[model samples]
Target: STVLLTGANGFIAATILRKLLERGHTVVGTVRSESKATFLREQFKAAVDSDKLKFAVVDDITAPGAFDEVLRAYQFDAVLHTSSPFRYNITDIDEELLQPAIQGTTGILDSVNRVAPSVKRVVVTSSFASVVNRTKGTWPGKVYTEADWNPTTREEGLKDVGSGYYASKTLAEQAAWDFVKEKNPRFTLTTLCPPMVYGPPEQEVPSMVKLNVSNLDIYDIFNGASDPRYGVWVWIDVRDLAEAHVLAWCDAAIAANQRYIVSQGNFSPQMFVDYIWKHYPERAAAKGINKHSPGKYYSDEGIYGVDTSKSVKDLGMKYTPIEDMLRDTLKRFEDLEAEGK
Candidate 1:
């Protein structure tokens, strides 16, 4: 299969690109710049040398028909769109978060519909934000599935960065489904909604400052910047999430035009802290990492539960244990530190 992966240099997309190549698929990855393309080429030298991996630059995904040129250039069997912004430190919510996410998604779909009839499947990296209801504040009995939709309005999104991100994901995914129904494109769509993805990145990290958002949350624990207690405990390993994308793309049996919630179940900041303390005791002690009373900060009281049964049953998903994920993540950080990065 020939696949097009947008945001190929991203933390998650790097792993997806790797899995796609390992599965014997030719991949054309889209990055924002040639520097990123060079970085990816270095990261996957064998793939690039073998002509299994290639890259194209799509500088601004928000622009109208941002993907048209790329779509027309490649004979793509499928596409994995993971190019939306996820930052929160922005002033203009509409410009930074909303417009890019919505337009980037719709633009790609429109471009594919118009130019790439050979493309049969489109998989999007939607967020758990789209499936979570913020208003409920973790309704105790609520078991969130793919069926749930975050009812964040545009007005609510404009209020703050967090709300804006949630609303952006919700509205963008909504627009995707709406486009499929209204336009009836030749291809089918699959969206994966995963929560708080965490793992070692397959791409190059020049410094700790360059860490992706979710991995940054883990780094903060040692840096003394994180609160001991946090909510929305669900998360997935990046490798697992990447596999889910590949599985969703190739498996025809997995229903199309549906959202899959890919999660490894519940977790808390304390759980991460505990794991580090137990495994890397020296580093934990050096960093003065608190071994927050076992399970004290973790509770099911105010947090919602996630059901990954659908993903497991449908995509044949299997989760990477938290221990392994943390170990690899910490090891990656150690390597970076040794390199003085």
Candidate 2:
């Protein structure tokens, strides 16, 4: 099968690209620039040489007909759209975050429906931001599933940066479902909403400074931050999330038009800090790492729970343990530090 992977240079997309290739699928990845294309080519030189991997540039995904050219050129069997703005440090919430996210998503769907009729399955990387309603706070005793939706309005989303990001995801995902229902496109849509993806990146990390947003939290702890501010407790390993995307694409019959909340389970900052301190005592001592008291800040009852039963039963999803996730993640950071990156 030939797959078109959007935002191929991103943290999650990079791993998804690797998984697709391993499954004997030819991939055409889209990046924003030529440099990004070159970097991926270098990363997968063997695949490129064997004509198993290729790249295209789509500079502005928010622009009208952003994906029209690419969709017309390739006979794509499936599309894994993972490109969207995920940054928080910005001035204009609507321009920098909301519009791009909403438009980029709908733009691709329009293109696939209008031009790429060969596309049978389309998997989108929507975030858990679209699943959990922050206004509800902890929502004690409530278990969140694929059916839950973040009730963030466009007006409220414009109030703050965090809300803006959450709104972007929610609105974009909503737009996707709406498009399919109204347009009746040839392709079936599947959206994987995973919380706090963390794992060693499949692509090369230029430096610790350039680590993805989720991995940056771990780096802060390693860099000797006394407080590990735990936010959303649910998480999924990058590898597992990538596998979920591939499974969502391959098993078209079961995954058709489904929204899956992919998660390993719950975790806290204290859990991660304690694990590092216990396993790498020497490094912990050298870096002056402070381990928060066990169970001091986290409680299963205080936060909302996640139900991944749909993902497991439907996609045959299996998750990496928290300890293994931390080990490989920290090792990757250490390797980068050792190389002065």
Candidate 3:
């Protein structure tokens, strides 16, 4: 299969690309600039040499016909759209979060419908923020599934960065469903929503200071800068996520226009501290891991749970344990630190 993966240089997308390439699929990754395209080629020189990977540039996903040329050029069997603004620090909520997310999603679908009729499936990367009402405190014993939708308005998103990101994901995913219903596109659409994704980086990172947003949160916990008071307590390894994307794309028997929640399990910073203190005592002592009280960093009793049975049953997905996730991630962190990154 030939897959068109948007944001292929991103942390998740890069892993997905690697998985697809390993499965002998031809991959055309879309980046926003020539420099990034060059970087991807150099990074995946083996795949490029084997003619298994190629790249295209789409400067703006929100522009009308932004993906038209690229879609028209490739005979893509599937598309994995993972390109959208996700930074917590936003200057303009509409410009940064809402517009790009909403427009970028619809634009890709529109282009695929118009130009890439051969494409059979499209997978989008949504978030748990789209389903959970985060404004209210976490509800204990409340198990969230794909049936839930966040009831947030643009005005509500404008109030803060986190809320705004929630609104963006909710509305963007909503727009995707609406487009399929109204436009009646030929390809099946599936959305995957994972909360608090963490794992080792697959894409290049110049420095720890410039780590991606999701990984940055994990790093903060190690450095004891992140407050457990604001923890979400759910996580999925990136490797598991990358496999889920492939399974979702390949499985056509499952219903279309469906959403799947992919998660490993619940977690908190205190658990990470405990793991570090037990496994890497010297490093933990050097980093002052036990300086803070673990009780304060644990998830509140009212924290909610997510149902991931659909992914496991339908896609044959298996999750990695949180302990393994922390160990692998910390190993990568230490390697990067040794390199002065």
Candidate 4:
């Protein structure tokens, strides 16, 4: 089957691109620039030459008919939409976050609806931010599941950094569901809501300073720049998350307008620090990694846990433990540092 992977160079989409290739699927990846398309071609040179991989350029996803030409060009079996604005620090919430997040999603869906007749499934990378209500803390023993939706409005997103991001994700995902409800396209939709995707990055990391948002805490902790402040303390490995996307794409039973909560379990920065101190003592000592007292860092109020039963049953999601996620993330940092990157 042929797959169209949007945002092919992103931290998570890169893994999805590779996984689809490994599964013997021909993939057409979309990037914002020629440079990113070149990077993908070089990264998967063998696949490209064998005619199993290709790329396209869609610079601005919010533009009308952004994906129309590409959708018309190929009979894609699945369209994995992973492109979204995810900056934490923002000046213009509407332009920077909401417009790209909301319009970008709708534009692609509209294209897929109108042009791509062969596309069977469309897997979107929604975030846990769209599911968890940060303001109204979760009750005890109340594990968040796919049924929950983040209650953030566009007005709330205009208030602050956190609300803006939450709102972007919420509105973007809501738009997707609404499109499916109204348009009733031939392709089924599946949304994966994973929190704080942390693990060894598949994409090139030029420097430790340029680590992705999810793995920044590991970098900060190793360099002694962080205390054990556990914020939104849950995660899923990038690799695992990518596989879940693939599962959602291939499995017709699981692809029917399902929203998956793709989390492994609870985690914290202190846990990473402890693992490094105990397992890689020499490096921990060299970096002067400090383990703050447990009382110092704690989970945010109202944030509790996530349930992955649906993912496990529907997508066959076998989670990678947080300890391994921490160790491997640090090892990637070490590998990059050794090469002086």
Candidate 5:
């Protein structure tokens, strides 16, 4: 099947791209930079040069039908919308975060509307951001599931309404669902939401540029900062997340406007620290840091967890065990330091 993935060369999306290639699907990924696309061509050269993979430049989402030219020309069978602006802090919050997120959804769906019959399914990389917030984002002590929405509307006040990224995603997802129901297009749409996603880097970007990463977020948990507004914890392996994307696209039963919480298990930063201390004592201590950061850092329980039952039940995806996934991730981080990539 011919597949199109927006934000093709991102951390998690790169994994999804690799999985799609392994399955023998024809892939054409959209990148904002032709130079980055050239790097992808080398990394996935066999696919790119062999005509199994292609790249298109799409620099703006607010551009009407940002992907229309490519979508119309290629006749893709599936589309994965994996690109979104991620920011911890935004000066012009609405433009940087909201515009791409909410507007990007509109643009992608517009392309689908333009080519509804040709596109079989569209998978959106959403977040648990759609479900809860950091402080009183949802409830004081609840594990968010597919049934829950952010519930933290504009009425809730922004002091502790969590990050702007949450606002962007929650609003964007709601808007997408509204559009899907109103239009009732032929294609199926599914949103895969994960939280606190942590894993090793997949590709090399400019060493000068640093994206706010999950691994570092976890590291911050060890430094004694806790947000007491949540209790449900959720984490997913990068590789497993890639595989789940495949299942989301290939499975017939997963359909339009459905949301799947694509998490493997739940863990607080404290518990995850303890987990590493027990399993990987040497590595943890070797980093010139305390191996355990339980009570000092996070609460015994926090609202960072999610229920993976729905994804497991419906998609038949078997998530990798937490220990193995973390072990490999840390090792890869060390390997990067060694190679200085």
Candidate 6:
């Protein structure tokens, strides 16, 4: 069965794509340019040459029925809609986050509705932002779950807490459900919600290993040292996330129409860093990074604990500890830089 993965080149989605390939699933992925086909081919040689992978350029997702033509030819069995604007900092929330997040989703759904009736399952990538309420402002608690929607997450509201990015996801997902309700669509919908996805490099994608989301605690994991949060806190591994998705695909008992918080155990980056530092002290000191720090650098206020029991017991998700993720992430980057050196 062919899987249609939008945002084929995205950081997180690529992990899903790699996992799909490993599972012997045909993947029809989207890229922004015809020129990228060669690069994708090179990167996905195993899948592409196996006659199980194909690529198409979806230059602008905002175009009405953007994916109809592609799906017209191939009957995709599943759709992994992972293309959403993800940026830590943004000034114009409307233009940067809302437009792409909303239109891109609706536009793809519009196409999917028209073309691929064969698609049975559609997994959309959402975020913890959509689940937990505004923390920087007013947070009810430090724990959240799939049952709760972010407090300010009105889905259809002016830029309040979510600004535009979160608004977009909340709205777009709402729209998807609404659309499904109206049409009684053939496909089942599930959303994968990840909170500060932290883990080691399962593959060579730079985004997978690099701490791209934060410098000084971007919702989870502190900077400079391993925080006590690592001992009791919760964090999601990208691998675990991928595993949960795969399990969702297979598990029939689980609710097909629902969201899952895809994370494992929470540990501080310091424990992970120190673990690696112990093994590679020379590597650490050479990098000129401050190796010593203390206290609860990773805080519940910074990163509220999330319950993934549903995703775990239902989808059978086993998350990777933060320590291994930290060491592996650092090692991967260190190796990458060394390659150039």
For model 3, residues 1-341, the per-residue Cα lDDT tens digits are 99999998898998898899889999999999878777578878999998899889899899999999988887999999999887887889999889999999999999999989999999999988888877565678888899998999889988988888999999999999999999999999999998888889878788887788988876766765653435576789999999988998776458367799999867766777677667787766776655456445544475788899998888888999988888899899889888888
Query: What would the per-residue lDDT of candidate 2 be over residues 1-341, giving only the tens digit for each residue?
Result: 99999999999999998999989899999999888877789988999999999899999999989998988887899999999988778799999989989999999999898889999999999999999989778777889999999999889899999899999999999999999999998999999999999999776678887888888888888878546866788899999999999999887479999999999988887777788888888988898988668556555468788999999999999999999999998888888889898
Better of 2 and 6 by lDDT: 2
Clashing pairs in 1: none
TM-score of 4: 0.94
- Per-residue lDDT of 163 in model 4: 87
TM-score each candidate. 0.96, 0.97, 0.95, 0.94, 0.87, 0.82
Top lDDT prediction, candidate number: 2
Q: Which ten residues in a row have the lowest lDDT in candidate 4?
A: 294-303
**Order of quality (TM-score):** 2, 1, 3, 4, 5, 6
Off by over 4 Å in 2: 295-297
User: Which of 3 and 5 is ahead in lDDT?
Assistant: 3
Ranking by lDDT: 2, 1, 3, 4, 5, 6
Given candidate 5, what's the lDDT at residue 272?
A: 60
Cα lDDT listed for each candidate: 0.88, 0.90, 0.85, 0.85, 0.73, 0.66
Model 2: how large is the Cα RMSD against the reference? 1.3
**Tens digits of per-residue lDDT for model 6, 47-131:** 7877888988888877788888887879887788888877646776766677777788767776777778887888878777677
Name the top TM-score candidate: 2
Cα error, residue 175 of model 4, in Å, equals 0.4
In terms of lDDT, model 1 sits at: 0.88
| Candidate 1 backbone overlaps, count | 0
